[model samples]
Target: MSSTAPDQPSPARTPQARAGHALADAVREVEHHVAAAGWDAPVRVFALVRTQAALAAEPGLADQLTPDVLAAARADDWHLTSVEQEGLPAAEDLEQLLAALSWPDAVDGVAVTVERVVLPPEAEEALPADPAEALEQLLTHPQRQDVRLAVGVLRTGATWCALRTRAHDADDAVAQGADLVPGLVAAVRATLD
Candidate 1:
């Protein structure tokens, strides 16, 4: 007898699939942590490291993590630990900021979350060409929408993104996919290279 019905596919069992799931989970966790801090926050970056290795390097860290986190870390050798990058130097734009970032070999993956004012396509036509004026227009435009984009990428090239709009602030309303923000994914992926 077949182990699984033909119509019902089996769950992802490959190493890459597992890594993808782990990376997505890590990205969502980071996004939720940032969301809890409220909106209008600065661009936040985090390095994803293997929890098992982290624990092996510093056994005292186990005391800092919650029971759930510790349990999960113990259960999965590939579990990731998010280490926030603080004291980041100021940069003019997301592109500039990401361009200046580089991770050590120890880092398994990286994530970045940032808020942006999104304007409808029609409203974009009326905005001034100057960067500062355009931002001012976007900030005050009646049709403007605020969105927080969280993107994560592993060294193996797996990518996942989460987008939360200010209008739909609920956790369940957050959107998740591998290509939600391709530009951001590419930028974050570049840092891992």
Candidate 2:
């Protein structure tokens, strides 16, 4: 007897089917990272997915993402950008994840910059003691009202850090990092698996 379940319907071929197609397309993109970098290295692909998501969320960013920019980011093994440095989501989380991933002394250099962004307040609040202090110092500095933080980590042992100015709450920054970093790492791992 056939093992197929008779009650189960065949796969759909409509726009909903296109949704699966879209997922497959995304998987193919993730596969490119695995092929180029080892499956064990999650940062490379994670960064790429994050970049793509950010681009989607912010219109006009996709236009700025030229082949050269992606190539450069891939060559370095990591890239990060946002609308603004100070308030970008998950900066702290990314930093912590990179640290956990044993990112090289110089790897993960963030170059892209954006404005009017802030980290989730919870993530900012959860920062490890030392970096939290530094962030606090940056925040309370009388001259600045807002700041941006972008970072990239490469497999070649280099890191890039960037920050821009805008209004932000320190607490929110921490919260954003707390929420995003774990999810990003998990998504990359899921794709790789």
Candidate 3:
């Protein structure tokens, strides 16, 4: 049986919103497996973005280009980039990374994913100093630490985020049914604007 009411038409979704929602869904699907491994695991993330230069490079897409509108972009410009864990700023310094991100007028939207630690800092200190005793400590208490979360964001003015985490609250918009990483999502959105 269908859960949605038959009388209601589906709402229209913008390309950015659609991509954002899809990315979040992707994160949710991957959450469990990453969390299963113990604390402070790392995940790698990337963003897929389009630019005028890219459109101009491809002969097939060139027909749609407006030279006056996208004159600032160069053939070599690329928006898509690894977020972090590829030994880059998206992990080492997200704020700085976002400060440098912006979509050109010819760009329609952007998509990005982030892989990071979900466990609170306190969890790491709980680990025993002795390697031999660490396993025993975790096994005995079973605190369920060491979660790695991956989040995806899509934006073009409006923004939507998908996240995978040990914590999820479907009823909460803050979670957005994808996940919430608070500061990280906001930083990414700021860059897009």
Candidate 4:
């Protein structure tokens, strides 16, 4: 029942692909954690650091995390631990906030979770010109959909995105892919560089 050629291994079996898969797993984990806090949350940011490095830097962290966490860190060389950045300065928009960020060498990647009100293409055409009026219109648009978008990007260029619509709010309902939100992914990736 296997369609893959026996001599030539599947691309998923390659190390790069494997690392991308692991990054996706980490991104999903962070998304689920944020989702648990419910909707209407402020834009939250996280720094992705190698768990092994975190453990090496602060051995006391070992006592705080569960045994499973410790084991996971030990199992994967590239296992990442997401540390939330709190008390961030207010910015005009997500892009503005992200534009001001630059990670230290210790950080391996960055992730951001934000909620946005989206309107269908048809509804967008009739929106008001004023910024405030447009925002109010988008909020009240009949075809509006509230969405929580979580994007993560690694220094190595691996990226993953998770999108959960408020209408279909559930862990299983989240859509996960490498480029679900390309624009946001690019914004996050820019911080790494």
**Prediction 2 TM-score vs. true:** 0.24
lDDT of candidate 4 over 1-193, digit per residue (tens): 6788888768876656756876887889889999999999999999998888999999998998889988988987787888999878678989899998998999989889999988888889889899899988888888999999999998888999999999999999999899998999999999888
lDDT of predicted model 3: 0.46
RMSD of 1: 3.1
lDDT of 2 by residue, 1-193 (tens): 6555677544553433433333333333333323333222222322322343454456576578788655644443213432222323343544453344321222222222222224456655555579768577545554444443333222222233333333432322321121133333333233222
lDDT of 1 at 16: 74
Q: Write the per-residue lDDT of candidate 1 for residues 20-72, one digit (tens) a residue.
A: 88899999999999999999999999999989899999999998999999999
Structural similarity to truth (TM-score) of each candidate: 0.90, 0.24, 0.41, 0.90
Model 4 regions lying over 4 Å from their true place: 1-15
Evaluate candidate 4 by giving its C-alpha RMSD to the native, one decimal.
2.7
For all candidates, what are the clash counts?
Answer: 0, 45, 2, 0
lDDT by residue (tens digit), candidate 3, 30-106: 34334445345543445444444455456555455466424523432322222222444553455566676665544
Query: Using lDDT as the measure, which candidate wins?
Result: 1
True lDDT of residue 64, candidate 2: 80
Ranking by lDDT: 1, 4, 3, 2
